[model samples]
Target: MIEVQCQCHGRLNELLPPSRRHRPFTHRLKQVMSLQQLLIPLRVPHPEVDLALINGDSVPLSRNIRNGDRIHLYPDTGDLDDPSLVLLRARPLQRPRFILDVHLGRLARRLRLLGLDTWYRNHMDDRPIIRLARLQGRTILTRDRGLLQQPEVTHGYYMRATSPDRQLHEFLARFEPWPWLNPFSRCSRCNGLIERLPESEVRRRVPPRLYLEFRDFFRCSCCDQIYWQGSHYERLRRYIDRLGV
Candidate 1:
C-alpha cells in the first residue's frame, strides 16, 4: 500500500461540501498510481485546468505518484506566479464559449442573454456533450460531478450552486466574464447571433400595437425569432443591473 499527503488550496476546497473540505488529508492507495488516479477518489473535477505541485515541484496529471509524496493543488491562478511552475491545461480560449449539461438550461439562457456563446439542448446526452466540447474547444459547465470527472473534459467546471441566480453569481466570480459581456446580442432559445431588423420587415410578425409602440426590432439570424423592447426588456435590464457588470 502507498500513502500520500494531499492538500488543496484557494477556492478549490470550496467546491466540495463542508464534510469533504478537509485539506492536507492523507490518501492511501493499494498501489502506485498517476496523479489523475489519486484525484478520482477525492472528487476533484477537471483537474487539467488546475495546478498540481508534488513535493515542491510542478508535475503533470500523468506523473506517477509514489508513497510518502506530498502533493498540493491550486485552482485558477493560485500560486501560479512561480517561475518554475508548470501548467497542466492548454491556453485559455480567446473568447469563452460554453456547452452546458442538461441541468443548466436556465443558466445557459441567462448566459446567452448576456451575448455569450452558450450551447444547450435538453435532450443532449453526456457522450455527445463531451464530443462537441472537444471538437469546438468549448468549456463544459455542468452540475454533474461525474460529467466533469471525465478525463476527456479538459476545460470544464462543476457548478456548486443549485439556484440559477446563485449559479450565475458563482460563475461570474470564477470566470470573470465581464470583459465579454454583450447584452441582448444572442438568441436565448437557439444560441444564434441576433441582428437589428428593419421595422417594415417585422411589421407583420408582431402585434399592431407593439409595432406602433416599439421602433427598434431585432431577429435571430439562425432561428428567426423576433425581439423587441417591451415590458420584458425592463425586467431584463433590472436583472442585468443586479449582476453588477
Candidate 2:
C-alpha cells in the first residue's frame, strides 16, 4: 500500500476534485510503481508537481515505490540554486515568444500588448501548433490538458484560470519575462510593431475633431492600424502597471 498526501498550492489543488483536495489517500500497489506512474494515473501531470517526498525523503519522479511507502507532494517552486529540487520544465526561450493554442486568443492579444511576441490563430489545429512550438522554441499556453500531454511537447502550460485577466498573472508567474518589455510597443490586434507616424501622414486615418483633441498618433508596422492616447490608453496603462510591467 502507498499512502499519498498533496499540499495545497499551485495548479495541483485546482487540478484535483473539489471533494479530495488536500486530502490524504492510499493506493495499493500490487507491484512496484514509479512516482510518474502513480501521479499520472491520478491526473496530476509532471509540471504540476514540484517536489515528491517518499517517506519524508525527497526523491526523483523515476524513483520506484515499494509497498507501504508514504508520499508527500508539494507544488513548491524548487530552489533555483539547487538543480536537484527544480521542477522539470523546458528551458524558457532565450528570446521569449509564445504560441497560444486556439483557446487563448484574448490572452494572445494581451501578451502582445505587453510587447511580448504572441502568435495566435482561432481554432488552429494541434498538429501545426505543436510543430511550430518545436520548430520555433515557442512556449505553448493552453487550457487543454491533453495538448500539454503530447509526447513531443517540450514547453507548455495548462492554464487554470478561465478569465483573460487572471491568466496574465499566471503567465507572469510562469515565465518571469527575460526581455525588457515596453507596454504598447506592439499592435494589440495584429501583433505588429507600433511606431510613431507623422501627424501629417495620419491625417486621413483620424477624424478631424478627435485628432485635434489627441495630437499624438502611432501605427502598426504590419497591419497599418492607427493608435492614439485615448481614455482607453489610460485603462491599458493601469492594467499593465497592475501586472507590474
Candidate 3:
C-alpha cells in the first residue's frame, strides 16, 4: 500500500475523512494508481481544480501515485495574476463569443440585448456544452464550477455574481466589451443582423399609428422580426448609456 497526504481547502473538509480536517490527512491506496483514481475516494470534484502539487512539484492529473506522496490542490483563479503551476486548459480568444450555460439564461438575453454574440440553450447537456465551446472556439460562461474544470473545456469563466444586472456589469468589467458593442445592430432574440426595412414595406408589421407617425424601421434578417423606435428604444438607449461606454 502507498500512503498519501492531502492538503484541502477550508469548508472542503467535509469532503475528506474526519481525521484529515484542518490538518494533513493520510490515505492508503494501492500502488500503480493514477492521481485521478486516488482522488475519487476523497469525494471532492477533482476535475474542477486547476492545479495539483505532489511533493512540492506540479503534476498532471494522470500522474501515478506512489508511497509518501504529499498532494495539494487549489481552486480556480480568484484573480488573473497568479503563478502558473498547472497547464491552462483554455486559450484566449481574439474576438470572444460566449456560450452560456443553462443557469445564466437571463444573462445571455442581456448580452444579446447589448448586441454581443452570445449563444444560449437552457437544456444543453454538459458534454455537448464543453464540446461546442471547444469546437466553435467560444468561451464558456457558466456558474457551474464542475463544468469549468472539464479538461476538454479550453476557455471558460465562472460567474461570481448571482443577480443578472451585477453579472452583466461584472462581465463587462472583466472583458471590456465596450469597443465591440454595436447597439441595435444585432437581433436580441436570435443574434442575427438587423436589416434596414423601409416603413412602406413593414407598414402592416407595426401599429397603424406607428406607420403613419414614424418612417424608420428595422427587421431581423434571420427571424423576420420587425422593430421600430418606440419608447422601448429610448429606454434601452438610456440603459446602455449607463454602462458608461
Whichever of 1 and 2 has more lDDT, that candidate is 1
How good is model 1 by TM-score? Answer: 0.93
Give per-residue CA lDDT, model 3, range 1-245, as digits (tens).
Answer: 78888887643454456777778878888667877666566655553455677998877888998888898866544464645566423335888789999999999878888788888888898899988877878888888767765656667777778999999998997688788887788887777889998646776677788888877889999888888888998898898888875
Residue runs of model 2 more than 4 Å from their true location after superposition: 1-11, 27-39, 50-77, 80-87, 198-200, 204-211, 242-244
- Top TM-score: which candidate number? 1
Candidate 1 ranges with C-alpha deviation above 4 Å: 17-22, 77-80
- List, residue by residue over 1-245, the lDDT tens digit for candidate 2: 44444444445777778875776666666567788677665666665566776776778777887766777777665554665563545555678888998889999989999999888989688889989988988878888877766657777778888999899887888678846576899998888899998767877788888778987999999999989999999999998888777
* Total clashes for model 3: 1
Compare the candidates by lDDT and give the number of the best one.
1
| Number of colliding residue pairs in each model | 0, 0, 1
For all predictions, the C-alpha RMSD in Å is 1.8, 3.7, 5.0
TM-score of each: 0.93, 0.76, 0.70
Better of 1 and 2 by TM-score: 1
